[model samples]
Target: MKAILAAVLGLALALPAAAGVTIDAFKTDSGLTVWHVEETSIPFVALELRFKGGASLDAEGKRGAVNLMTALIEEGAGSLDARAFAKARDGLAASFSYSVSDDTLSVSARFLSENRAEALALLRESLTAPRFDQDAVDRVRAQVVSGIRSDEKDPNAMARQAFDLRVYGAHPYGSDKSGTLDSVTALTREDILAAFRSTVARDRLYISVVGDISRQELGPVLDTLLADLPETGAPLPPVAAPAFDGQTVVIPFETPQSVAMFGQPGIPFDHPDYFAAYLLNVVLGGGGFESRLMQEVREKRGLTYGVYSYLVGKDGADVWLGSVQSANNRIHEAMEVIKAEWARMQTEGVTEKELKDAKLYLTGAYPLRFDGNGPIADILVGMQIEDMGTDYIATRNDRVNAVTLEQINRVARDYLKPEQLSFTVVGQPKGL
Candidate 1:
């Protein structure tokens, strides 16, 4: 009897577990895609809205317009001034903010379910009817311009900007996500309004709501908030894959630590090999102290305090980046170590122990990403924007676990070529 009972228990444990949270997704009548995760454990709710055109959609000469427009949305919208907007949101104890990334513009709000009406009202105003007051635009532009000047003084920032220019060339991805000082200075209220009008259409929008709310309860709220938005806008043109010619960009800078950035074109988000590439990056450099790059470069040689690598998966393109900082004298050695590691991974590949450890860390840390409503909302929005299925959270572990040694080696051979990488070192080399 004991043996039989133990057998049954073991079999049950071996079965794949279901996701702790389940997402119910559908499209709103307004042509907005909505994803809902209902968790009554908390009394609060979180909402996130994503729009297609981010910095990548900036016009040829109007680089910072999208970003500046996103900021101004929260500054004043509908009939409220910036001060009135703040007071109203604070009175309701709601948290509302907007941000523009390379690929998307997002607005998020977290508030008690009791205050959902007010929160949605404010969010709706910010989304569809932003004032874009001239005063607000001028104020935000000054801040953006100041930030650009500040970046100019930072060696690491200079290194990355140079790397982007070299790796991406004339591609839109090559331009700074934050506009240049000249570009920001050239921007006007007209530019911001035009960008907002062109980008934030209903069909291009995705909304995700998580926390103590059901789709039935939330559907009406969404309808009311998004009612004024237009159903469609101009579809974004497809972005081409960045071609990386083996080039070295050396930008002279006076800093104690030389910043080195290097990378090759990588797989986009929708690629079949994405899971393999993701796991490979973890084993290569994304795993912090346990990563091969950190273990090889910093621990053994004392070359730098940290070294890391990652993949950027955008709507139309992707790129791999590896970065480290070291004394000017050690920059070449550091680059050699990076290149050697790349070659080794491509040829010899990772061992079972390395692969297993990476899987453990990735799976174990996955739940920590949901510690707050804000992060949970962000993840949901990202899934909708990336076209990743609602089951992504549930299947993410399986995806990482499915990456076999054979798959790793095959992907490494296909994607990780050392000679094809472009290197950018920003600082004076000791003997250059």
Candidate 2:
């Protein structure tokens, strides 16, 4: 059945994309809002569920409780033990993945229309009746601990942690979501349960379903699948303040190359000039080899192999950030080049050609995101999370194209701060 589903998705991808996408939005009897795209061509359904409060909902000292609970969700449920749960899920050839980041917990599911009931029943059990048996908790906790230990020695991880620590201070975003070794070791089963209950309630849930489901079928489906969840989860954390000081901080690590994470403040998604900022980022550092940072730092000076930047507008905060790794000896030069480029953009902004190319690439690439049901479902959920309307799909390209060069340049001058760009370098290098 999985193979058949895969083949069906492949065929769907091969067909030409429709010019416009029609999304139907409705709420279930239980007041669960769901966005749906009914693609009848395939006998498969791709469903995505997003809960707003993610690892950030960890209770006091139980830092990684939410992450650990998410990992244990699929380990067992109701009457099914870990191995039994796997066997049953495989029997139906359904797929389910549960993941949590700092601000969101996501469940992605794929199943044939015929197996919908079984898949959703199994899914419900996982959500509302997770066993969190001692052995499964211990096993998954060990895996998470192992990963935490591994990250402690990783240079890139060092840079990220260092950067987060400086920017977020006491905010939950400052600490790693996976928790410290001691915190994970001390987490009790009750802690995991608390995390689960606090994170999985209905008020925080956003769902999107694509393929093989209709408005009528979806209402009962959502009610039956999700109505069991509590009415509300724990309150979300307070808004974070990202303090990006214009300073270069170094962590001494033994590595051939130094990894640098650099960033400053950024605009929110709903901000009116976000498209201009988005286009500006594409020209400045985000557009692969064509980006100004990549061209200057890699192609021109051969200072690094690759460099890129992006906007991260997390629910609590927003920032413009980028990374690059270079040999310890060349890292200083790379840092200087990146800073110069940052300042250059602020002073001169992007050329008309650069802005045009960014608009063209972004607009042209937007439609390709709908190639498969799963991707489309994921996109739909993300759009909803960003509070975008259903017409966003149809109007997105036009918005991208409408970003004038003057607007991007103005955003560049207003938002980019060379002096405020913080660089956290992780490696032992000769120079500053």
Candidate 3:
């Protein structure tokens, strides 16, 4: 399904905009913000709720507690057993999903409008009074441990772990969300409860609703669903700026190809030059084959089959990062070419043609993401999380369009740091 969406988005790059999605913003008395759009074509509602201090709030020695608790929140809640909860949800033809990432615990609910009340009741239980049954905790913990065991041998995972450890040091961001095998195995029920209390709270909530629902109907539902949470999250782990000092660390693996993850500090989401940096990223490395890194490493030198880069702008940290996989003997050539392109773009900004092409694709393809209720709801919550304005959906492409070539160049020089790039390579490579 995601591949199909990617294909449609590719087509959207050439096509002009459809009418922009009309998103309405509201707030409940409990201080929870809601972004809504009435897409009644489908008789279903998609709800997304985000709580801050997600996996990052895991207590000492309980690294994966938040993740484990999120997975079990819906497995059993209130008085319902895991089987009972699933049966109840399935009876209503509703779906509930919970996930925890480095920054947030995200809950997604989808249900037919006729079942809204029942579905919401289930969601409320999961949020406000999750049972965290010992049986469910044991099951979920085992699953996360299984995943950790799998990641231990995966080269890409190894490279990513090395990269984060090098960049963020001992910060929470550097910790794996699923945690280490020993950590997951040692997690206690009390730790899970503590993590749940600390992470799912009213002060950090962001909510969005889309599809067959009205503001009047949703207002009370919002308060009922969220009013029971704690007012504030536990103190988040301290913020630490990324410290990349251009060192290459190689993890030896018996493989034909070396996977390299390179990164440096990047501009934050709230920076005035963010949109410019976003546009600049496209020309520098985010444009796939059209990006300079791809042209230099793959099309020009044939050192790698593919290469790409992107910007990661979190609440307190940012990174300009990229990855490439190439034969062990050719990895050095690929790295040199990637570094050269990174340095070159800073010295000589992208061409006008490049700028126009990027703007055309970025602005034209922006609306394709709103083609479904779930995606739109997700995007709405994201807008609030990023502190963008209510009319941001309407004005976003204009912001992308407003970035001039000179501005791109200036931000490029200010932001890009080829010399500070740190590389973490997995596999036996010829050179570093």
Best by lDDT: 2
State which candidate, 1 or 2, has the greater lDDT. 2
lDDT of 2 at 201: 92
Q: Which ten residues in a row have the lowest lDDT in candidate 3?
A: 9-18
- Specify the highest-TM-score model's number: 2
Q: Global lDDT for candidate 1?
A: 0.81
Which lDDT value does model 3 have at 144? 88
Given candidate 2, what's the lDDT at residue 400? 89
What are the per-residue Cα lDDT tens digits for candidate 1 across 58-147?
Answer: 888888888888888888788998888888877777778888877788888877777778778887888877888888888888888888
Candidate 2: list runs displaced more than 4 Å.
15-20
TM-score of each: 0.93, 0.98, 0.94
* Model 1: how far residue 219 lies from native, Å: 1.2
Model 3 whole-model lDDT (C-alpha atoms):
0.85
Local distance difference test values of all predictions, in order: 0.81, 0.91, 0.85
Q: What is the C-alpha RMSD of each candidate to the true structure, in Å?
A: 7.9, 1.1, 3.9
Arranged by lDDT with the best first, the candidates are 2, 3, 1
